[model samples]
Target: MKILITGANGLLGQKLVGLLAEKEVEIIATGKGNSRLPNPDTFTYVTMDICNANEVMETIKTHQPDVIVNTAAMTQVDQCETEKEACWDLNVNAVEHLIKASEANNAFLLHLSTDFIFDGADGPYDEEASANPLSYYGESKLAAEELLQKSNIRWAIARTVLVYGIAHDMSRSNIILWVKNSIEQGKDLKIVDDQWRTPTLAEDLAMGCWLIAEKQAEGVFNISGKDLLTPYDMAMMTCDYFQLDKSYIEKVDGSIFQQTAKRPAKTGFNINKAREILGYEPHSFEEGIKILHEQISAQ
Candidate 1:
């Protein structure tokens, strides 16, 4: 099988490439520019912008891939609030272009989404729950989902949360990295005690994506981690796991920090859909942190 992955240098995309490298499939990876990742000899790279519909179509036509996994997005929550047009263009418009290209090339498209679509009014949302996005970033992702549903193409949407792990050449700035950096630098870390999510490890999420692609599972699926915790709780756990000073971590309410984007108070998701359909059993938050610590130690 010939597979093409967008955003190949990203946290999740790089992990996916590593996982798929052992398989018999031929992989063609692409990013916004000339960013390259450490990979096996079998893999190939292309630098193409997804926003250019004509260029995207031409590339898809040339590659003739059987599957296209799209992980590209403007995921900065605060930035999306101010740069609404750019956010929509990258998240929504670019996805539409990819969907059209996938249809033309007769390829199955697996698009990565986020758990931010929930308003946080509810504690934990299932796949059947309706999306009520609180931020422009979430709204743009939801709009992309709507477009995918309307298009006459083979597609699957995976909604994930708090993804963190090793990347190829790009720097990842997730909650895990922030806490690690603070502890390593002997600096105090202030984390929000109210905001909650099921922090997923990028490696586990990559495996789940491969399963979904292999099964050709269509429709929406919540592929988040099993455990849920607030940012403060996650920081404490990370400190404990790494044998760092707990005094360096402090808890702060979400309202204390003013931001352009409104974060969901409790946006944890229930991954029963993934568990039942894809047989996906994600690691707990503690296990994820332990793995992260080990990966960091290796570097």
Candidate 2:
């Protein structure tokens, strides 16, 4: 099988590339600029911008991949709020471009969406949950999902939450890494307790996408960690995993931080659909931390 991944430089994109390397399928990894993958020679790497309509069309046409996994997006909520046009271009418009390309190439399009689509009023949402996005980032993602929903192409939406993991050649930090590093440096951190999420490990999310691709699954599926936790909970767990000082971690609420984007108070996914249909299972948050530790230690 031939699979092309967008945003190959990002965390989820890099994880997907690494995961796909072990499989028998052929990979075409595409990013906006020079590939940041540790082993770019392992597979086909292309510098194709998803935001460019002509480029997207030409690249997909040239590759004619059996599956197109789009991991690219302007995911920063505040950034999206500040730069609405760029956000919509990458999130929604680029999706339309991919949809058109997929129609032309007859490829199954697997899109990576966020849990932000739902308001925090009530969470641990199923695939059938009604969406009421509170932020521009969420709105952009939802618009992309709606495009796919209304399109006549083969597509699947893999919605995830608070994805955290290590990636090759990446200086980017997630909650786990941030907590560990901060505690090691003896820096006190204020973490929000009011907000909740099922923080997904990047590898688990990659696996979920792979399952959808392998099955050519249609419609939406929640692919995230089973645990529903807050930032404070995650910090405590991180401390436990690393045997660090918990006194440095302060539990706070959302109002403390002044941010451009409004965060959902509670938004996690219910992965029952994915578990039942795709046989998907994810690691516990502690187990996920252990995995990160192994990677960091090896590095």
Candidate 3:
């Protein structure tokens, strides 16, 4: 199968590229910047700014891939809150471009969504749950999902939460890495106890996307880690895994931090739909930590 993946430099995109590298498939990997993937021969790299409709059209036409997995977005919650126009452009407008282009090309699309679409009034949502987003980021993502539903094309939305793993030259750090690094360096860290999530392993998310592509699954699927854990629990687990001093980790509530964006108190996913329909099973948080450790250690 021929696949075109956007945001190939990001965590999920890089994981998809790596996984597909081992398969007998052609990959067209596009990112906003130069490709950071080490395996040059694994996929063809294309520089694309999806917000530009022209670039989107050109990239889609050139590849005409059987599947397009769009992982690109302005995912930083605070950044999305501050840069509303930029967020909407990337998250919603670009999706419109992709939907039109994908429909024209007859390519199946597998788009990524987040758990933030829910207000966290109640959590562990399935695909059937109603959305009531509180933040601009969540609103933007939900808008994109709405667009996909309207577009008369084959598509699937894979909603995940707290995706954590190592990627090549990544600017962001996952909770496990952050906790392990901070504690080892003797830096005191304040982790929030109020917020809870089913922190997804990046590999598992990539696999979920792959499953969507391989099966050509339509509609929405919740693809995330099975364990619902608070940030404090994650920190403690990270400390335990690394045998680091947990004393440096101070548990705090959301009240103390003055974040630009309002975070959902608890947004976990019910993955029974994914498991039953796609045969998807995610790794436990501890296993995810161990896998992350292995990757970082090898690096």
Candidate 4:
């Protein structure tokens, strides 16, 4: 099987590329800028920006992949709120382009989505739950999901929550790293206890996407960690794992931090459907931390 991955330079995309490389499938890794992968020669790499309609169409046409895994999007909540047009163009319009190209090639399109699609009034949402996005980022993601639902092509959406993991290039810093760094430096950290999520490991999310592509699954799948935790919970866990002082961590509510985008107080996913259907088993939150620690230490 041949797979074309967009945003290959990103955390999920890079993870997907590395995971698929060990398998029998062919990989076509495409990103917006120059390739930042550890070994660019391992697979076919293309510099195709998904925001460009012509480029997206032409790239898909050229590769003619069996499956197209789209992990690219403008995900910064505040940035999406302030720059609405760019958000829609990448999150919604670019998806339209991929859907069109997928239909033309009759390829399976597996797109990555987010837990932000739901309002925090409810917790642990299933695949069939109603969507009430609170912010522009969530709205744009929901719009893209709507496009796929109405389309005729074979498609699947893997919606995840607060994904955290160390990437190959160390270009991204997640909650684990942030908390670890602050606490290790003896700096007091203020974490919001109100906002809750089923924080996902990036590797687990990548595996979920691979399962969707491998099975040619259709419809939406809630792929995330099973633990429902707040930022303060995660911070304390990091402290315990790294043997740091918990006194340096201050638990606070969401209102303390002023931000442009309004975050949902609680948005966690119920991954029972994925577990039953795809045989998906993700690492526990503690196990995920250990894995990250090992990776960080290795580097």
Model 2 TM-score (2 dp) = 0.99
Q: Which tens-of-lDDT digit does each residue in 187-256 have in candidate 3?
A: 9999989999999999999998888899899999999999999999998988888899988988899999
Q: Which candidate would rank higher by lDDT, 1 or 2?
A: 2
Worst 10 residues of 4 by lDDT: 34-43
Residue 60 error, candidate 3, Å: 1.2
State the lDDT of candidate 4 residue by residue for 75-103, as single tens digits. Answer: 99999999999999999999999999999
Runs in model 4 deviating more than 4 A are none
lDDT, residue 108, model 4: 97
Candidates' RMSD to native:
1.3, 0.8, 1.0, 0.7
Q: lDDT for model 1, please.
A: 0.87
**How many clashes show up per model?**
0, 0, 0, 0
How would you order the candidates by TM-score, starting with the best? 4, 2, 3, 1
| Steric clash count of candidate 4 | 0
Provide the global lDDT of candidate 2 against the true structure.
0.94
For model 3, which pairs clash?
none
Give a tens-digit lDDT track for model 1, residues 64-117. Answer: 998899999999999999999999999999999999999999999999998888
Candidate 1 least-lDDT 10 residues: 166-175
- Model 1 steric clash pairs: none
Steric clash pairs (candidate 2): none
